[model samples]
Target: MAKITFIEHNGTEHVVEVANGLTVMEAARDNNVPGIEADCGGACACSTCHVYLHPDWVEKVPAKDAMEEDMLDFAYQPDEVRSRLTCQIKVTDDLDGLIVQLPEKQI
Candidate 1:
């Protein structure tokens, strides 16, 4: 299982042990971690699951595709370097301690 820590805008943190192969959005939704609306499920069509990965963990994740990059452009809280759609992030054994921070709003 990968242990994920989701830090909310207000500094509250929620942590969960997510199963490998599951998307970060799925893990957040399943564990009731706030700030990850996952409005489009895990389809990567919506930017509602936007998150900011910790700087150290950024290089560990795969590069974002053009489509995902486009969707992120519509994110309410955009950060060119750290913003990401959580629905596109798959949990893996190597990501055991992934840490992500949620934006103030997803809309």
Candidate 2:
């Protein structure tokens, strides 16, 4: 399992342990971490689960795919270097201490 931290726009933090094979979005949704609407239910079809990786974690997680990059365009205030769709990021031992910041809103 991995312990992921989800920080809301206002700085509220929710840290939860998630089993491997689940996506970061699922972790947030299951733990009721506000700001991650996950409207698409972990599908890459929407950007509601968008988040910005903490600076220290920018290069640790798996790189975003073409579809995820494309979908980010629909997120709120997306950052070219830090923005990512949580649904596209799967949980793993390597992401045991992953941290992400939620946007002010989802688009």
Candidate 3:
């Protein structure tokens, strides 16, 4: 299992043990993390699950696909250099300690 830390806008943090092949959105939703609404599930159709990967950890994550990038344009917050849609981030052994910070809002 990979351990992913999700930091909410209020500074609250939620850590979940996610299985390989599971998306970060799945882990957060299953663990009841509040900020990730995952409105379109894991289909990459909505940016409600947008997250900002910690800068130090960005290099460890994979680059976003065109579909994910397009969806992120609709997010309430603009995509920063570290921005990513949690639904597109699949958990892997290499992402064992992945940390993602939530944006101020996701509407």
Q: Per-residue lDDT tens digits of candidate 1, residues 1-107?
A: 89999999999999899998999999999999988898888788889999999998888988889988999988987888899998888889988889999999998
Estimate the Cα RMSD of every predicted model relative to the unseen true structure.
Answer: 0.7, 0.6, 0.9
Model 2 agreement with the true structure over 45-94: per-residue lDDT tens digits: 99999999999999999899999999998899999999999999999999
Worst 10 residues of 2 by lDDT: 34-43
Question: Alpha carbon lDDT of residue 89, candidate 2?
Answer: 94
Q: Can you list the residue pairs that collide in candidate 2? A: none
Candidate 1 worst ten-residue window by lDDT: 37-46
List model 3 lDDT by residue over 24-99, tens digit each.
Answer: 9999999999989999988988889999999988888999888988888898776557889999998999999899
**lDDT of each candidate versus the true structure:** 0.91, 0.93, 0.90
Candidate 3 lDDT score relative to the true structure: 0.90
- Judged by whole-model lDDT over C-alpha atoms, candidate 1 comes out at 0.91
Better of 1 and 2 by lDDT: 2
Comparing candidate 2 with candidate 3, which one achieves the higher lDDT? 2
Q: Name the better of 2 and 3 by TM-score.
A: 2
CA error at residue 22 for candidate 2, angstroms: 0.4
Model 2, residue 30: distance off in Å is 0.6
Winner by TM-score: 2
